[model samples]
Target: MTTQLLSRWKRSAIGSQLCLDLRSPQAYQIRHVAPSTNIPWQQLSLRCAELPPKNVPFAVIEPSDQKPDTCSQWLIERGWQCPYVFREDDDTFWTAVEQYSQPTTPKPWLLFRPCPFLMQHINWIEKQTQQHRCLDIGCGSGRDVAWLLSRQPLWNVYALDSLKGAVERTHQLTKNMGVHDRLVECLQAKITSEGKWKTFDEDSPAVTAKNNTTATAGTSPTSGTTTTINNTIAITNGDIDDKSRRFSPGVSTDTFFQDKLGCSQFDLILTIRFLVRSLLPQLPQLLAVGGYLVISHFVEDGVHEYEQPRKDHRLQLGELAALYGSMANIEIVVDVIEQIEDGRPVNSVVIKRTGP
Candidate 1:
């Protein structure tokens, strides 16, 4: 393999390219290239968010003596531009591997940052050094929750998500950080406006990875007909008995909060990249007086079309400002469509509950 790219990267400025060593920790510790962060290939999905934004180019070092094609493709699918994946036996690169050590200081990009809107008003958060409660709705992968816990020692975080994988990931992240005790609970829940509720049969066999049979049943809860999960169901994070404990996917947000969360109030409630319009009206009730509501999600931009999030999932331009600005109890602090680091536009709003 050619060392032209590797040599150029080595000679370039410090921040020119991020070198990711997708190797086992044991192998990397013994001998690894300079300026590379060791993120094992198996854990890539979980750790990818900690890497630099997708726009930054990467040079991947494959695990063992394996080819880099698969690892490179994974990055590409996630909007990353990986220019090179170093071969294990590349003599030129391997010769200088142990010469340099990984940097002692944490790279800015590797740090899990909260949303920009929150950082902009970090002074407000810092002021609340005393005990406070924060709720993270749709806490996917738990980065934001983990960041909040790490940011303030006295603050307790309650994270809620619909997916089992999300809850497990959040738990794992918090546990790994040694802040799991402060994380009140990462509840697996779906917030909805529909009134229908159903119970899954606990007696049913847990779906095995190999079998991959989806559970479908007669009498659809929504339409009073039949419904089915067509493809393979990937719900291995929890057991079949755990299925019985889940709230019906159609329970209203208000109902779930009351029943599951004990109608608790929060000093800060964050809903990032997840939108449920019906849940907006209940925010004032759930938030304590003087609490802040931070919402950052994709908005309907006239110029672009997105496949996920759908049209209804996004807020119309100035929708949040218009709605919250008129609320007598809520004060619109910041309402604007900001282009984030990756160039996607998100309507970030920070509102405070001024009255009970």
Candidate 2:
């Protein structure tokens, strides 16, 4: 990487991102970037598996004489986004280091940091079967989507948002995190919209047949009749052709969810800050037997700092729990209404779908 570009990256928000110091432990202990992770160069091969997700921005810092070209090549071949190297002797190296400062507050990119409640119950989640599928409703900027993918690298994650920007941001963020494009599918569309779901042929070039199969397996059994249409549009490196962007699966949210993701249900469904009351009734249909559903959002308390004018949008005390309590198929695992450190009254519930 050029010094100018390196300097620019260092000055930007990406600079505070993770860094990998490839020096020996003793060398790293003596002097290294303030917030970098040390995985000595010689041990990189053994410890490479421990590296963060590809979407995370990271740079490799190595000794002056030992270039990591081979190491970089090895990582890139195994799906690690190749990191830029900074030699110890370079003048720009220290400049980049000097500019590094850990973020004091949570940034938008990190907004989906796992909820403390979820963290407390992480053992419950980890005990579930592997290769699980997850859905993130109102996946704004994909914070939770990214978190889920990072936490369960082998799992498939599907994220949806009504806003185009949010969907695009989720896609971009996941891409930046180096998530395999196949592992995540993002859509800009409302979940409640009614329309006939359309299907694509397995041989269609627009999306791989494997992806189509994965998605199709998730559709609801009652989702009724399907039509197969051959979409000739080509996909390159997981990106649709610009001319065919509008017709691409990424843009076809309804079709993607209804048809491509046919009869499929998720092992985990998450609704964070965003809430659509209409979605509550539909949650059961979307969850697999034994799947968990987590929902957290603002509640209607008189202590309004920033008033949510829409009463329908704000939950009443115990309302969140009641929504699931009435469901015979769901078992409420965790339910609480408390003022977090931020002093906002929120209702949170975690429930498991116990029956069909």
Candidate 3:
């Protein structure tokens, strides 16, 4: 069986310092799979040097399982020096399992990003976001929240969730991770929903009604008796002025440093595997003047032959990158990755907003 040969080949490959696979001539011509090759049986005698340094175990994986009995007998009599043969019917499951058991991954905190995607390219982003304040949006069970905090204990974490029991569960999870203090109480606010916060037009009507009644202001000239101007109108020229209307200053995260109940101020923000169109454009503003952003998510490539994105809120391919185009410190991420060094399939990008 092929498994038995691979078992022996894996062992023999250890001391030789080189492992080569000569699979098929056609396969080599088409894709030329990296680290795998095809060495024709007839030409190998003249091309043995074309194979790799014999300093390591050199293997020739051929598609042939049947050979002349005399050919088998001749190779059999040649001792252990003959190239290991990998045939088509060889069941390689056991051999792959044996090789997979070896230690992999840079460290153990990456079980969440456990695919050959995003985490493979995370080193630079990780190094940049570590020491800053961060918020992990859509933190389901706090697994990623815990992983990020575990790497940098000094960083403050605002773990947010919109589910019914998400806040409580995040509390329990972070407590289990022994990082409750670093984690701010879970925010139960829904990032979506137009009614989550009272709209300006809706909120303004109440204030306008109030101002019309009791608030004393310079009166408009009646005609003959009074000739005075009234500039105290709540609506400026029939439009609501953001500066004049009680600007909610809307729950900014900046209050943290002032020892006040902060509105959500963070030096860095992270959202992974989640999308909301309204939130996309505001990503640049969430950070402080010089804040950084790290976002990773599933993006379409415009090629999948399905109904295309149009007149909808869902992000299309390259949409996330385009959102911050005019921003002073914007960096857009593209998903065309060259290396699979990390064990996951991921699309990730880091944006740094330089201070004005």
Candidate 4:
């Protein structure tokens, strides 16, 4: 594969293909193929979102000592299409990088837009001077997380997602935006009933922590913060929070959050485009007094072309208002079904935990 890739590079200008140098930044700075982006091999999983669409073909430049097979397999598994692998040690490869090093017009990088609902209502956070904590549930791709970090310098953002890939993408996106330092953590665990989320896979570590703390199985750090795999519970069609009118007392939801998230409460809690009826009861418990909770997703009556949410997952009309309205110490800030330009109706609600 290296020989063939080198042959192709020699025949055509190296500028023709999108090249990703998998070597470390230090090594890449010393010497690397011209017009190549440096993303270390180990960071590839987290930073994979920075790459162009999976359909676009690209080349991988790896360290001379390692086999290109590993790099190729990793890219393929991530849905990245056909990759051309080359080693830095190859004389032909080095010569081609130098010979055809002239810069080519760069391709447009992919753009990620933040959630519109969050953008409109999140103005209050930026006005405050004191540092605050925020939690984003189902933080797919981390657009909102990155936006919050970029917009408010004093806020420490935490992200959660059930999928490992989603967590990785969120981490990488924040890192790319240069706000990763303020990103408290990204948790790869499903929001099961209270403490039901247990580690099912220890082979893959759940998080990268600071100061020797880790979410890997069997090791309980004194800090009470932990991580878990994407283990999920049964999704019921009925609204348990509405029916019960109060969260169950058995599981002790606060303990689960304290141990998993490291913090028992957040100033702002958001779950966008994600619906789990049973999880609704847990949001208020996760919010501190005077903090806000936001929920937005497709509604059952919403007319749209997209499918797969199923009737069970979509929120019923007035469901958000009814559920949170009856709950004590809760105030509904905003509750309405908004229609975007695409004609899709989204049920959005914002509420504040007014009392303990």
Candidate 5:
């Protein structure tokens, strides 16, 4: 299709329904049309199943080196309606869209900074194989998730948190950074007990369903929201028991996390600033052979003063390492207690699974 025609179509209401950017995540990062869901050309075949229904009209923004006809033909064969493909060289399309600009300086928020320990060991991480999958447990606001996505073509991050607001914030950060292509998934879940995780579905009857609200799937990532493809299953009905502070369940929570993760093993699993001792035993099972586990959390040192004196939440010296002492086929890369510039003493451990 001609650039002018595509541009005019994009302005129409129908065009707003589905606009895809069929460029590499790297290319999309450099420049892409706003509101377009980015699914890299290389991943199109693998992810096409997640696209909107066949009846929905969609358009694709192809790279300069790719043939528009070839891409459209591939999609057509896979049940996608004839998709409008616009080449990168189309000046009219490029001139009509707004390009994202990178910030000249770092922001002051600590939430935006990558953990010092992660940064220090990034060289070791890069030396491993490509296309690694990482899971961030208790991923508040998803600082680490954003960092992993920034290392695109290398890592696919899955972030989880119990707070709905935190999960939503992570989605916003991923959208703002234009790295939705690298984020595997972000879920609202809680690791409440050993080997048991629960996920909250807002569309459940106890929440939006009772109101007769219909939930739509295949939402644009840039729309500042994230949702699952399956809306059928939900952990809770939104009824919270006051004494226990837990939501009333509508379904079993046993396999909810695994179902959402879509994998039993991950290349890396990170838990930062949040500690759950119950999850320690399952770390070995979650990590693939040669996979790494990085965890960092606050420690109770008499020298440091705290606003809240919750000793149970603070780790004792060498306590973090002791939890993994019985785990087999793992090598400890780094285990130490260090005080950051902020005066918080943290126990950080980086271990690698060496056996199947």
Candidate 6:
């Protein structure tokens, strides 16, 4: 398409269209776009006639790392009026010079494979899944969600990530792929830590008269602590019962997070990067009798001071899966994955809770 038309095509305010690299006599052709009439850059002298007329103000997007000036020079010599130039555009024609040269895909590149670390889990997802009530808990770029949805558009999916940027990006990706209504449920809720929460003072002059806000649940601002020295009240929900409870406050669904995922409970819960101990125990309860829990993260070798993941709030040992192994009704398949990134080897574990 002409550059003018390309620019006018609304940015979609979504995500960029991702495509395979194309080069030479043939290229990665989409169903809608015709086969690109591409010839090697070296033959520009002979290939000049194959291009558009000289009067057409054509535009070209060069791979930021490739040679654009050289290609522009050749086009000019052939009487082509190529008036526009772009230093970076990974999704488009890249000077036509790199029809064969492919050390890698262009920069700011998304992973060619979505679930690289857990191919087994992906395969299991494809084979064992009866319904596509899939939830990608930490979908970075919607790759897995897109891949699965494209494989089965009828399946229901909830794509979520903690990072707002990633959630929006995934939402855009789903929209761009025409799966907005099928596989896109972008949310910003985060996994609450299992750490103990204590109440803080809610009284003193800071307590409002008009707002009608008071100490909720198990906590009310202590009178003596109003000086900010001795006051202590725990985090409480804005409910009568909340004021009665003293610990693990907040409007968190620590008990039934999975039930609130969708209509009932998601058949598949995909989590990466985040970890919580209490969540692990209830995961089995969240699933239908035969629901699957697929998880992957970096594992510790027992050498670290704490059995904690290096950066994220992930598990240290691969025992989190084994934590539920004692339950005979569930099938626990847990093991360490291959080391491909900068850290120690990762781990992927799946637990399919069965009926007794």
State the weakest 10-residue window (summed lDDT) of model 3.
Answer: 223-232
Which digits, one per residue and each the tens of the lDDT, describe model 4 over residues 44-135?
77666566456556777877667756787778897875447777677776765676565532322223346678878888644532447898
Name the top TM-score candidate.
1
**lDDT against true structure, model 3:** 0.46
TM for every model, in the order presented, reads: 0.71, 0.54, 0.45, 0.57, 0.57, 0.53
At residue 296, what lDDT does model 6 achieve? 76
Q: Compute the lDDT of residue 126 as modeled in candidate 5.
A: 60
Cα lDDT of candidate 6 equals 0.49
**What does candidate 6's lDDT look like per residue over 1-356, in tens digits?**
53443443223222122221213322322111221223335444432323443444554433334565666666677675545544344445343323323344222222134555445566665566676577676687666676566553266787655344456567765554556777646664444455322222234333443434443333443321111112323232223332332222333343324333434465677776556665566566556666677877666645434444554554656577558777768887655555534445666777776763
Off by over 4 Å in 4: 1-110, 128-130, 193-195, 199-252, 302-305, 340-342
| Model 5 Cα lDDT, one tens digit per residue, 52-167 | 55655677777777765777778788777655677777876676554321232221111124677987987787677454889889887677787777773568888888666567
Tens-place lDDT per residue, model 3, 1-356, is 55565567657734221223334556535432123434445544433323332223344444444452333234345432335554433446324534433433232212122222334544555565534677776676666666556564366777665442445556765564466777764654434332121112225333443343333346432211111112221222222232223322223232322333253456667776566655666667667655667766554544333332232423455565666766666655433422223222234666776664
Selected candidate, larger lDDT, 4 vs 5: 4
lDDT of 6 at 225: 18
Best of the two (2, 4) by lDDT: 4
Off by over 4 Å in 2: 1-112, 192-256, 302-305
If ranked by lDDT, best first, what sequence of candidates would result?
Answer: 1, 4, 5, 2, 6, 3
Candidate with the larger TM-score of 2 and 6: 2
Q: Report the Cα RMSD per candidate.
A: 6.6, 13.6, 22.1, 11.6, 15.7, 15.2
Who is ahead in lDDT, 1 or 4?
1
> What value does the lDDT take at residue 197 in candidate 2?
25
Off by over 4 Å in 5: 1-111, 207-254
Clashing pairs in 4: none
Looking at model 2, residue 167 earns an lDDT score of: 65
Error of 3 at 26 (Å): 59
Q: What root-mean-square deviation over C-alphas does model 6 reach?
A: 15.2
Question: Which of the numbered candidates is closest to the native, going by highest lDDT?
Answer: 1
C-alpha positional error of residue 171 in candidate 4 after TM-score superposition, expressed in Å:
1.1
